[model samples]
Target: MAFITKTHQEEALAALQDLVAIPSVLDESQAKPGQPFGPECLRALEHTLALCESLGLRTFKDPEGYYGYAEVGQGEELFGILCHLDVVPAVGQTGWKTEPFTPVVTDETIIGRGTQDDKGPTIAALYGVKALLDAKVTFNQRVRFIFGTDEENLWRCINRYNEKEEMITAGFVPDSKFPLTFAEKGLLQVYFEGPGSDQLALQAGGSLNVVPDHAEYQGSEAAAVASELKKLGYDFQQQGEGIAVAGKSVHSKLAPQGVNAISRLAEALVNTGEFANPILEIVGNVIKEDATGESLVGLFTDEVSGSMTLNVANITITPESSRVGLDIRYPVTLEKETLVKALGEVCAEYGVTYREHDYIAPLYVPLDSELIVTLLGTYRELTGDMTEPFVNGGATFARAMNNCVAFGAMFVDTPDYLHQANEQWPLASLYQVMEIYAETIYRICCK
Candidate 1:
């Protein structure tokens, strides 16, 4: 509250409203040479960088459309505030009271996609730095806001940024909740393939990071599958020619909290005793309803980030080939190869060979580091909250750099609506978050 004013709050909120108005979801169909992720992501990046320039910061838009940045101050040490513009697709997600892309502002809240995920927080941090600059505060280190374009997908944008942009001395990803996050679980996405049976065909789910909400299969063998799902007491519905098995959808990192619709369907199919797909058998018999990697005999558990979680993200089966995708978040202290090897051992029994689709190594920073100390001190001084830094299965831009961690955008009471239906931001927290960022930046970089 010290650095930001009512006028500044109005300006910041207006900026966020304008940003949330854009439906900047990843669209590969409109992808071109310079716009690798798609036109929307490129547009979002361009818009965000332009906003930064409008705020009187030096800005640069990447020619390849993978990333962008805005900066102020001059020093050998560079402080980064990592943010992303691209958000998860919101069109099909249920439970929206207003249009997902249309920013609906009330007296106390703003409802829109990307509001709480990253965009709203990004604007808060931007104005936070702008506050110090406007007050003519001299920075002892360079402060830069690195805009990422493909954070919801494979992180190709930030990967391109790391390949092309200058590395920061240290920073925080404004994309996550805090006190602060000191560790993150390792993320592993694997694609398993096996021989396909011409007798059956199936396909379900999307976005390797989101657990499917409904496995509505509308193909061959509907009656049998439905009968089995009913006998199994699974939540499902009959969809004319097929059946839809219902599951609670959530981010893959929080798989323990969600139900895997794809797995549900697979279980029903296997129980039918009519389907002979090896992949389906594995999903039903091997991994059945287990989020804690219990199928693997608890091979992936650690004290820092807790037990490994698995989500049957997607599946596709055909006569030519059978494929299934998995999203696994292992502990930071666990060995990746050991877990990978254990998975392969079990999967190989069904003639299913596994290949890693993507892998992000875990992130860990000591609680006593200068960056942690400064950010934590700033947060405590502002809120009087003594909650220590913690770890989770979530992955953020904090993994993009060595000295970075995820600092608070959400306080203790803020519900996490990131990547969820009806994502929203509380208006009351905006000024406080901006003030926190302003103060944190001052203590960490300006001083």
Candidate 2:
């Protein structure tokens, strides 16, 4: 009576369809009225927990909106599988071939916002757990699946989970690339304010982590800026009170090196003869240096997160002030104080104010650890693919646990469109991931 039965596969597909049907994007509109984490995220978390309950597994949930479980198993030292149900926002007009939230099936690929980034694998892991349970696998350790609601923006949900849950012996997160992830660069969010106030009209980007494919701004003085960009072959759209600047959407702001919308807007301003604003000038300087971390202050790069990235996600201007939110993913090896010192120097130079908010230091587990070997072995056994464990810049809940590493749901060759328009996952890969999870759980439990 193993969990990997045909019945389990049927349940897996059914659960995936159900999970994808819920438009679980972290709605920004809910930020001010309800929880800082969106209600949709909370709903997704509940849905996941209820699914766990239906599978006949013991579960744990805190009022603060995080949950975990001791799946049907027996072991003293718990083995953890960390994953998240929350996802980034998806704009409808972002040129999605299919509606971003609607789960579409084309050529065996399940397409939606969370399919590749996390939600698909989250369900896959659930079925994997089911497989292990149904198999009546016996072992010397407990297997717990930890699901959080805020992995898209911040990891507060997991932070809270660790505060109340039991420490895990070893585990992996199915949220990142396959093979394995041994290192994750630290994360830092830098907020900057410049001298321009009341006179500036602006709009560009959303979410510091995402590369904005479209953004623009307009004011009484916007014509000059628009005209300048037009000369560069940039087309600006006049929508509502502002303009829309467009660019291609991409992921992992560090790699692929896509054009940043905020950076592009700042460049437009500087080139359009609007550099009179000291704040705008400072922004230009910041981009020119391409500095995203504290290393520039001392001229040494932080190696863990690699170089810092300046993802100027959101911008706002009032009659009296202008501010920007920068998502800076820091190197794990760099000291937090070093980043602080770097910010202090930059702030002093531009006369712009700066602040550090939502800092998550990097998490690295030794590549040769038993937990890693076990997870890697499970993956290799299930897929017969020999891939090495590596490092990634994207953060996951795996780092939130005492002994954990991110496993896989996304194949190294397949494009899942995580955080991009028309995200998706192949059904074959989904089944493969479930089988891998089942093996990982079973091995970890038995050993």
Candidate 3:
């Protein structure tokens, strides 16, 4: 029997619309004492908690505004469903049919920043719990919908939540693909710094996890670089003595899908012999058009987690120095020490300093585990998908704890627009996930 009905879908849709309307992108400038993430993120958290409370569930908002949860049922053991309220920045992105934050509901889909990534799934899971509660289904364990505020940046909210809250026995995060994700690659965010040229100033890209879509270089050889860009058929504009190149943007996890403007600009500068030696060495030797780590350190691959991927996500050049940010997703079989050693050698040879910003160890749950079996069975029973569980390069909340993995919200063979412009999710897919969540919650918590 379907656990989610038309009324439930309508309610969930309404809740998602309200949540999507808030531009909950993290803003460091708006950070305060209580809301360390930012004002918009706090508002999104407060709104979600309020909605959960209105649904007759007990809720908790961390005093420091790091994380929050909505709870139902009563038991010593807790089963968690983790989701996030904050979204990636969409302020200056292009190709949106409407405003990025405005919820556009069509006959088939809901389009917005968080619609596909998390906010829609969060509301769907909430209503799933609401359905179970409305039906008066008894449960032997507690169910919690944990919400984080800094998922797009660092995972501070989840870290803080674990520090203060009770540990959940088993759980799933609805932020990845369906048929279950049993393994995830390790994540490493590294930064490289080197001396800069006084004759050139360069800046491009935004987040460390996104491919640079725009870049500009201003200096003595700007005109030569601009002429080279014209010959290369790039869309460029002259700004003062600089040239700005526009390229396609994509998630760092899929860096090969987009043209990185930073790399393009570097190529132009190198061809014109205007870039500094350090910059020339790093760009011409370390980074390349391909996402594979072949040109940087070395390539690592495994049967379970696939190959290593490296993305040059952000770059900035000033009169004094230049910094290049890289996002690397490595396979589980590789040792962190070995990778770091190789990177250090490369940096030393290029006359640059390297520092790692964040590191997330790989997550691999055995396929024969009870949690994986149960989630896979539930997905198969609901959607009849027989595809085997797979691995990915992206990190999720599931990596924060044991006995947890990412389950559903995205299905097999579906086009992923999670961090891209015109982010969207099918309306019917929401109801489908609602039914699956309700069944899984009932099976895990009630039975």
Candidate that scores best on TM-score? 1
Q: How accurate locally is residue 152 in candidate 2, as Cα lDDT from 0 to 100? A: 76
lDDT of each: 0.87, 0.70, 0.86
Q: Which stretches of candidate 1 lie over 4 Å from their true place?
A: 21-23, 27-29, 37-40, 87-114, 196-291, 294-298, 311-324, 344-352, 387-390, 415-424
| Residue-by-residue lDDT tens digits, candidate 3, 1-447 | 567778899999999999999999888898988899889999999999999999989999999999999999988888999999999989799888789999999999999999987998898889999999888899899999899999998899999998888888999999988877878888899998998767667777789889888888867777899887776676888999778888788888777778888877777777676556675457644575657777777678888877888888887778788888889888777888888999999888888999999898778888889898889999898888898887872578999877889998788866789899999999888889999999999888988
User: What is the C-alpha lDDT profile of model 1 across 230-284, one tens digit per residue?
Assistant: 8888989888998989999999988989988988888888888887888988898
The lowest-lDDT stretch of 10 consecutive residues in candidate 1 is 296-305
Model 3: per-residue Cα lDDT at residue 134: 83
> What stretches of model 2 exceed 4 Å from their correct place?
1-3, 26-44, 64-76, 87-117, 153-156, 192-252, 255-287, 290-295, 302-305, 310-327, 345-353, 388-390, 415-424
The CA lDDT at 296 in model 3 is: 79
Q: Each candidate: RMSD to true structure?
A: 5.1, 6.2, 5.6
Please say which candidate is ahead in TM-score: 1 or 3.
1
lDDT of 3: 0.86
Cα misplacement distance, residue 152 of candidate 1 (Å): 3.7
Tens digit of per-residue lDDT, candidate 2, span 381-403: 76788867677735677767656
Q: Higher-lDDT candidate among 1 and 3?
A: 1
TM-score of each: 0.76, 0.70, 0.72
